[model samples]
Target chain A: MAASATRADALVHARGLTKRFDKLVAVDAIDFDVQRGEAFGFLGPNGAGKTSTMRMIGCVSSPSGGELRVLGLDPVIDGPRIRARLGVVPQADTLDMELRVDENLLTYARYFDIPRDVARARTQELLEFVQLKDRAKDEVEPLSGGMKRRLTIARALVNEPGLLLLDEPTTGLDPQARHLVWDRLYRLKQQGVTIVLTTHYMDEAEQLCDRLVVMDKAKIVASGSPRSLIDQYSTREVLELRFPIDAAPALDGKLDGIAERVEVLPDRVLLYAHDGEAAASAVHQRGLRPESTLVRRSTLEDVFLRLTGRSLIE
Target chain B: MTGALRVVEHHLMVYRRTWKGGMFVSFASPILFLAAIGIGLGSLIARGPVHTVGGVSYLTFLAPGLLAATAMQTAFVETTYPVMAKIQWLRTYDGMLATPLTVRDVLGGEIGWLVIRLATTAFAFFLVMVLFGTVHSLVALLMIPVVVLNGLAFGAPIFAFTATQRKDKGFPTIGRFIITPLFLLGGVFFPIAQLPPIAQGIAWATPLAHSVVLSRSLAIGGMNPSALIDVAVLAAYATLGIIAASITLPRRLVR
Candidate 1:
């Protein structure tokens, strides 16, 4: 294929990729590139087509239209070849609950046609890498949610894939568990694994992603480094104001020009500005005192809300 | 070659770890059927003219038929629920597909495992039949491969069904609508000729009927040209079922 020349640097490349489910277009026409050994992310809310796009990249789902390549191979014709070089941690843990933790890793390694001795060695190494060496023999059904998630991550790493796909790696994890997973992922990144991940957590996006695309409703709204995205789409600081439901309108027209942008949410109003404390003081100077006020750095969450209106979509 | 061996190793691992419960059920059911039907129902038919191809007793005549039926039953049970679990509940196929193995390799591995399971169960049943003096001649040895073929006939179709099923609601329907009827009408308990002409014709169409006739004929040293026809029918069923399974498996899994 023509992709071989570019394969040296680009781990994943797509041109006008799109996926449609009958009448519903889950992933609209979009393009992106991921260089080797880079940590990339897809950040969006629920139903933002992140998982669908990941599935396409993982070679599990066929793209409806446009050009897509992974590891310099077409997914439709070379699925197994591409998939062999890819590791996937799906959004929902699809671990084999019937098997022991070690067995799960062993069985997964067998799929790669890895020799028994090699699979055994890799399973042991991965179990240690994910900190599940002690629970290796335990049945997966009895493992805690965090343990299972850790085991799933470990299983994905069994092949030592060149391109690792993690869809919401920290979702549903406790704070301690999330941090533990983050540490492992960071180590993998340092080891020169090219990671493509998707998460709704802004903190997770900021913590792991070297570059990201913010998706909303099946389309890319923006794409850049997290810092660059925040700088390009939003200001450096944010001032949060909380008002009584009845008194919110009294200050609405009074607080204009104090910040670069104002977003009114159900619980609070966010003011985007270069200086959060200055924006907060300006709000008070206009003879309007919110019930509570706090100033912090603007985040991807604010960027998402600014792009996609605040409506709870199913 | 390594791919096929990996599947075999996987099956062997699972069998060694889980077969205690399976062995208990496998031995118990056929023995209970032997006691209840062969002893309880055989007594009523023993007094009547014994339907012998070459001077075998009524219970002896019934034993080979039951063995083939049991092999098919075990194959169906193993291939259906476990196959469905691997596909849906367990997501084993998804995991396997992500590897270097193609969907055809998975199907080959599963069919290979079913053959081994059928052989093991048939061996155990053969021993039980021997203890009961069901062997009329050394010809009963040929019944082993016949029983394996019987398993493939049922296992292939069930495996194909399982590849398409998204839930377990249809499993009982397959048992009730297809398996149970075939068990009763397929001449497991009696000769097909005893049925009315139309029912006999319908019974002959089922793979179980062919299995019973072939196994019983061989058990009493009564092989004939029609045995070739029975073997051909079984081979046809197995080939078609396997091809259909291979074609359907990728469609289901790749989606």
Candidate 2:
């Protein structure tokens, strides 16, 4: 992992940004600053207003209230100017399926008023960059999900944008496909491109994000680095214990002092502790035998559950 | 301006790729209408003495209206479904908006492309009319520009309407309740003067009515001062429609 420099100059700055749909507030007043040459993330589950916020930054959707600046230009008065320097990959793939893969890139390039010859050259380079050179002449419909995503990324890069906004970049891909996309994004970040991404996948957020905000119900509940957030909201380790229905009650208060916190779920109980082995010893010392016991490091998922009181998947 | 031109170019590229399908549909519709209505239905109207305004057959009088009507229909269909697809189904405009092209540029390009498509279809219809002996004098050739203007006038409002649409159910409703009625009453197959006075007044409000009246006048080599008025009305609609689309399209996408 490349070390990211901490700076105060923001490439994207939002002050009390909010969006409303009818009476439903999609994105409440939230403020954040994304600096140059850093990968920022909006880490949230579905319906948390991540996509809405990204759209506002992308200049495709208007913010209902608050101030927003992209590349130091106001999104309302200077939308065209800001959009000229920004690239967006929406949550759903909106590729022009009617055109060939190469034609799609070339057509998008033309929208930026790129000359035909220049567009042609850029299309070739982008095709090779996405590893879709052999499929340049093929229709977009037959390409796999991963290829379509790569093409979308390539299309977003056609104008050589300064900031890239990706909404759920790896939402519905296979494991291998997700890694391929992650690798590609990592390379772009290495080249000093500023990336702002929204993802529900905890691993994706951990792997790509330098700093992130955890949004719930249209508001930012927490914001910090992954490691800092984990340390703030969770212990160093978590021990999971699953017992038979009858034996569960005997172990309820037997290991209270063994951990920092204990959560009793319907099916299982979790012990958040600084040391998992000591917690397990305490549990066994109380003569409570369980069906299964496992000790593992705490993750972002635990932090999300701890803060939101709902599992990310649920 | 260059960005708008690029949008126009992209539309042309798409048209080229799908030209065969487009030609088959656009060309076949008018020929089928000409055959089904003019030839098939004309035989039943009793060999009424050929109405000669400028030494042309009654069929010639009917020709220009059909040409203009066909152009309008082609433009309407082209802008309606495709515009809806770009706004809703395909989301092509959203992708384009990420570039330097403003929403005004997109609207300008789309309307411009509609005019070009209308021209191509009007040319095909004009040739078919000539083959059927319905064209008289060299003045009929001038109907091309007139038909294109007619198309823009009819298509502009439809494009604006489609941009505001969130669903497709109302599309057929508009086509059936509005467009089909205009087609039947706008003097496409017969003279509007032959209708009742109240019906003529209603047809006068329609853009197609102005187009048919002007096209027929040009096709028969008879120039009426009111023809220029009709042209001006169609032009006004085109200009206002383009402006309205430019203003409304951005709100639609950005909101």
Candidate 3:
């Protein structure tokens, strides 16, 4: 009966999900669905309600209003049941400082009622999977930031959860560390684990999320695959021209016929057009002298800027 | 209740890593204090101001009092800093909740571990009492669980109070204002009856004073059925502390 009611394949289904804290509406009437075995994402700026929505889906925070079902179970009624099948990696590293790396995973497995021997076996396997086997005996306090994040990821996988929720998985790491985590997540995706992550990095969203929702100010402003969102909201390419303060004119009026849209910034002018090369030549033909010029294909950053008119990172 | 034992198991694993470091401090400090106060002062206390307290040597009278005090200090130490650490610093409880465990299980397990630690510390202190010839009868062996209850009388409420705090600055305040005063005035060093009549009323009201009365009664083979009231007081504290923790821990952790 439960499977016959909602979408049989939808692991997480939310309709008009609202989360308010006192007078502040952190997540206001947002709606989305997460399908099984897909790498889904929630993309938004800071304070844009990304973490609030993830907490709701994680079954730790009950919604203020509206409907939310995770894995065909009511979040408020069967929170523990829903949580048993879901793995969560919070935004911050919550690893035990006193316990060793392997002890962290082993202690967590006991909460799920796993057998002691089975939990130990899984701990060993997960430590190897996250490439932390060498540091299994080391305390969590001494490991580097990236190593701690990997250990946290390993700890989340101790139960072999079907749906994994990652909230800002790599927010404070360098480029090398971020890629290492991305590589591990991509492998998990290939193995058919449903992944829902929240990130502000366009490249991270583009590289990992098969589909995503862009939220701004507690509402879903746009939702689609990264490629389709870029195509729907922006032109094919963007021609950037940085000119001296005095040389640049009323660029919107001056470059009217060259591109579909023109946005002027203090340091540069963006000419949105289907043919960036053509737009650049048109600017040269008009005898407009600029300091520098570059043409590139439209990216998720462009789509985000067009939708919210603010950068993803503050 | 379902997964409370698992929570205890988790704490046991963490304790395994650091137990050896605290071995000397857990047993040796209490032994030294018993020696200095029980023997050093027992000599002076033997001849001075009304010798033969409760018709026994001064060391024997103060031995049971030290047992109760040891239980109180052990409970406070085990519950306060560790509870605050798991709530704010280590974040281990948050990790547990992400699994199948609920807030109730976590709290139950933590208090359970505190009780076990109190028992072990009391056992070590009991050995020291024996070396000094303070154990007078077979009834003294029953005070192990009694000491655990006495510790919980303080440990449970302190754990509940520490769970609600945002910072650890209040911990030292509790030590200075609440714990220290209880140690000084709660009939640990001398009989509460020796104090002014008004001070005697206040001492009898403290949880430590109740435990001291019960332990000393049992140790010297002088217990009567009326001693059940002392057990009732400690049990009430443990129950109330558990209830308060169940209510307040989820508010701070789940949201």
Candidate 4:
């Protein structure tokens, strides 16, 4: 991409961007830079400032303290100018349910000052682009959840935005719906649109992100690619053992030397190891084979668990 | 404020699909009301000792007042729920803000659309008044602008108030307590002189009273120098409404 030659190859640059609402500090001082044509993900649990950061990047909210620059323009000074070239998918579906599917697209284009004919043509192309062409004449209220999401994505693409900021693009979607949304987003990334997304789903970050920053308690805890984060923070494999609750706590001592680290929970125990089969065999060698066991490769979820000391989903 | 007109343009597009729902209030309600009030109620008034009011038929005297009042009604209706829906329910304003539009542009588009709605419905009411032979002079054509002003006078403040609402329980009170009294007692059915002096003083402070006086004089043949006072009063209210909306809407939306 020609963006590599630009003066500021970073399309988004932030340093200590902070947002506070009264007594609560929603976003603590956090800094990150997103390069052009890169698909960056903010992976975090709720209340970790993912959505707040997205809003700041979208130019819809002002920073209470610190600096934020989108496309090299200060959001406070050039909000509208910067927003004209961006697309945002909010966490909730805010589609105009009263209008037909196509009207929502056309209305959005008008906000960018696109002429009527040009808007109509673009609306047509976008409806087809999101695979909602057949439902263009339908009311927005009745479309399925996934279809509504696709239509929103299409509406965002209507302006041909250089940067697309999606806040949990697949939060409420089913697995099938989530995959399709991810597919369309991947296609946009392949088309060279700079994309920044926020998600709590570690697999989503691993599946789609070229680079990711794990955020927690309003601060970034870890930042790197999925493999690098795992390699940096977690063992290559994890062994899971589920004993009856009465027997689970006592087995921790038996499996002490089997793996590098052990995580004890009420229902199961996680054994972090470089080789899962050898670790499970080590458990048997200690005469502690009273439960079921399984081995799996470490993922971003493990990396998150290692960093935050809490499960990603729970 | 660049691309502010697109906000109104966005509304116009939505109105194309949704205006039918509002037709009862905008077009049909006025015709039904004029027929019921001017023709039906005026017949009873004509039988009384004072058959003529202000040297004209009772129905003719009442037509301009109702037209101006209807303008206020339509403006209130257009500005209140639509603004509330955009801000709270439908979040259309949020949708616009996510684009290049700002909160001020959204407010401008909203108030601008309310003005057009007031004009269209007022024009429809004028035709209904003509059908009942309530229009007495050709200058009645100017009632459109006066009606638009009256609607804006009410719409602007309502927009300001509605933007600050988190729930809709207060909306019904506005219709019942504020708009209803203005419709009934703000000189819509009779001259404020018929009331006692204190009541008359209170009526003079209202936008509907000033709007009614301006509209009635414009519809009839005699609009004297005092009509300027009515214009100034109504214009002041409209300006206040705009100022208040600009302040409150951004405070509500930007947060």
Candidate 5:
């Protein structure tokens, strides 16, 4: 798939990469390449080996099999050199709780061997960028979860890395906080920094990733832009019917030919069709009554349910 | 090595903000021990027929032993819970690993910071000894190296063991079973000759006991050439601990 030509421009290239923890294979053979300045994503539920793949690219975990290259260098042999040009934000906050907000960035800069004055100037600018400039002198332990996440993001950009890797950048934050993080990440993407992030949130993937791969059970199930994946795997519109508890499955047989496909969850029946309103009218013509109906456009969640036959959250 | 030094610099930077909380213990503990034990208790023991401990006042004799003991305790304290917190709780090493720093750099930097800490506290305690008139000879200045060797001898091995730990339950065990017992019987309070033959043999095997001998001899200005063997032994322990940490740290960090 144009591997030879794109190899030169790919910031991260992986072919048949695998990771094993004892007898358990966390990441099976997976192949993907992230072009320069593009925000790529690995979207999957928990225990799906997204973190394992991200760590391998971050150069913190070794690949048990196959090959991986970051910034045109092997992760195994040139780890420090490759890591020098890469910024990593781990799933959990690794900010030093003992230091002030600004000291965290300053000490991190010293690891990159940035001189003190330059590091100080960049620290101020990063704090401003993350909107944590007011908390520069305060201790890190007292900051809220959102502030800590932003501080971690700011710390990651201290070296002006060519590639930034984030693992579940907003897993536990509230909706408001998640939106703020998404905004900052969007700005970074607009500033031409390559980003690689993993998330189980379909909305997060749709909001920030230029391209994404759907990973499930240690393998990549699909790869495309969000719109293209939905178009290829799901219909243009979906009709939602909320029936009594556990009754949605019994009615799947009665609604057969009106839609391209039908999915029966425990509490709702989803109909995939070109025109959701027509599907609803057909259901009404069949003398079905006593339920609520809603028609909406398809999203990545529908694409994921179509591809995996399971809900993203469950 | 420069990467390791950067790690050391990071610790130093953190210490700058928090050193005052610990300054009382690091610099003042030695003096308090000198006043309470050396001058206070020694006065009662001086009235006995045996007034001198190997040809010097009891204060002078106990000063260097406490110096070495303080270094040993400081090394152990720095290595155990703090190292565990960095690996498991605080995850500071994980942060460093994401940068240009390697596992070897983290280990080296930690040991280097321990050396700086041990050296400064040992020197400050030495000055306290001088202020109390316990130091009798200029050769006692050699105690600094002995203190540093004694520190690494404990710090490196403890650092290695801490790297392998997932929890801090083992640290209190190290303190109770290992550190406290050594502090009591490692010739810090009195000469090992006062103990029975078997206990003396056990005391001589510990790095703390050997450093006590080296430091006491240096402080008394009666440097025993035979104590050079203690130097070699402490150096061997320090070197082996450093090597062991080099192995275990990478194993724990670079997964």
Candidate 6:
């Protein structure tokens, strides 16, 4: 009966899902679907309702209105059953500071009623998977931030959940640490685990998410594959020009005909075109002597800015 | 129910990692109090006109009072800073809820662990009383249950209160204002009969005072039917605390 109530093809199905806190609306009416074995994401800046939506899907926070079904079970009614099969990594590291790293996973496995011997075996394998095998006996307090994040990921996998939900999986890590986490998540996806993550990093979304929704101000402005979203909202390449002062807006009129769309930011002027080199040459021909110019391929950042008129990171 | 037991297992693991200092503090504090106040003051009181309290030595009278007080203090302490850490700073409860456990299971498991702590601490204190020649009858073993009830009467309410707190600022206030006052004046050091009538009435209303009365009666082999009323009061307090925790903990954790 629960399966009959939801779309059986998708692991998560939300229709006009909303979350309200008193008078403030954290997540407005929005809709999306997450297919199994795919890496789906909610890409937005801070205060863009990404965490709220993830919490709703994680069954930690109840939605204020509309419909939400996770793993074909209603979150409000079948929360514990749904949660038993779902893994969640919150925005903050909630690891036990007093216990050793391995104990963290072992105790969490008990919450799911996993037997002791099996839990121990899984703990060893998860620590090895997260590259924290050496630190299994070490207390969690002194480990680095990246190590803590990886341990948290390992803890989430102790139950062998089918759907993994990570809220801001790599928000506060160095480039090396971010790549390490992404590598682990990619392996999980390959093993047929459906991954749902929320992040503000456009590069993270591009690298890990097979498909994503662009959320801004409590609503999803766009949703598609990364390449398709970029193609629909942005050009193939972008020409960036910077000036000492805020002169990009003044030169927006002159930079018009060279690119498909011209975006004049406070510090830099962006020209979206198929040939960034040609656009840069056209800017030189217009006698606009800028301090610097660079050409790069269009990224999800370009698509976000084009859709929301704001950068992905504030 | 199994989910709640899992929470108990989690706390046991936490206790296993840091049990040395905690065990020493729990066992040593009651013995230290018995030595300093029970024996030290019992000697001076023996020299006075009223040498015995309730037809026994002062040390005997004070031993059961301290037993009940130890239960109350241990319960209050366990539910305050530790509960606050699990709610806010450490986020252990959030981590638990992310699993198959519900808010009820988490809170139930926490109170269950509190009961275990109360039982162990009470039994240890009761042993010290026996070594001191304080137990006068076979019914003295029943003090363990009375002591545990006294603990839940305090631990449950404090656990509920701690769940609703956003910061730990109010914790010290509860310790200073409510717990300290009850420890000092609620039939611990001296009989509430020595106080004025109004003070006696207030003391009788407190769970510690009832537990102290029941514990003293059991230790001295006095079979008073009024002990049933004392049991009812302690039971009511424990039940009410569980109810309040059920209401507040979910609001804090599942939001």
> Candidate 2: misplaced stretches above 4 Å?
A1-8, A243-255, A265-267, A287-291, B39-55
Clash list (residue pairs), candidate 3: none
- Give Cα distance to truth, residue A258, candidate 1, Å: 1.7
Quality class of the docking in candidate 1, CAPRI style: medium
DockQ-based CAPRI category assigned to the predicted complex of candidate 5: high
Kindly report which residue pairs in candidate 1 clash with one another. none
| Docking quality (DockQ) for each candidate | 0.57, 0.71, 0.75, 0.79, 0.85, 0.85
Residue B111, model 3: lDDT of 81
What tens-digit string does per-residue lDDT give for candidate 6 at B1-255? 999899999989999978788778777887888899889999999999999887888889899989999999999889999999998998888888888899989988999999999998898888888888899989999999998999999999999999999988998898898889888988888889998899889889889999998999999988557899999999999999999999999988877
User: Taking the tens digit of each residue's C-alpha lDDT, what string does model 3 give over B1-255?
Assistant: 757898999878878887886666767876888788888888887888777777787788888888898899888888778888888887878778878888888888888888889888888888888888888888998888888899998988888898889988888898898788878888888888888898888777768889988899888766857588989988998899888888889888987
**What is the DockQ of the complex in model 3?**
0.75
Least lDDT summed over 10 consecutive residues: which range in candidate 5 chain A? A1-10
Q: What lDDT tens digits, residue by residue, belong to model 1 across residues B106-182? A: 88889999899999888888777777777778888899999899899889988887888888888889889878887
- Chain B TM-scores of the candidates: 0.93, 0.92, 0.95, 0.95, 0.97, 0.97
What is the model-wide C-alpha lDDT for candidate 5? 0.91
For candidate 4, write residues A1-314 as lDDT tens digits.
Answer: 33234437788988899998888888999988888888999998888899989999999999999888899999999999999999989888789877899999998988898888999999999898888999989999888999999999998888999999999999988999999999999999999999999999988998899888999999999888888899999999999988876876566467767899998866778899999999988888888865699999998888888888887777
| Candidate 6 chain B minimal-lDDT segment of 10 residues | B18-27
Candidate 3's displacement at residue B19, Å, is 1.0
**Residues A36-62 of candidate 3: C-alpha lDDT, one tens digit per residue:** 888999999999999999999998888
Displacement of residue A17 (Cα, Å) in model 1 is: 1.5
Q: What is the DockQ of the complex in model 6?
A: 0.85
Model 2 over residues A57-102: C-alpha lDDT tens digits? 9887889999888888888888888888888898888899889999
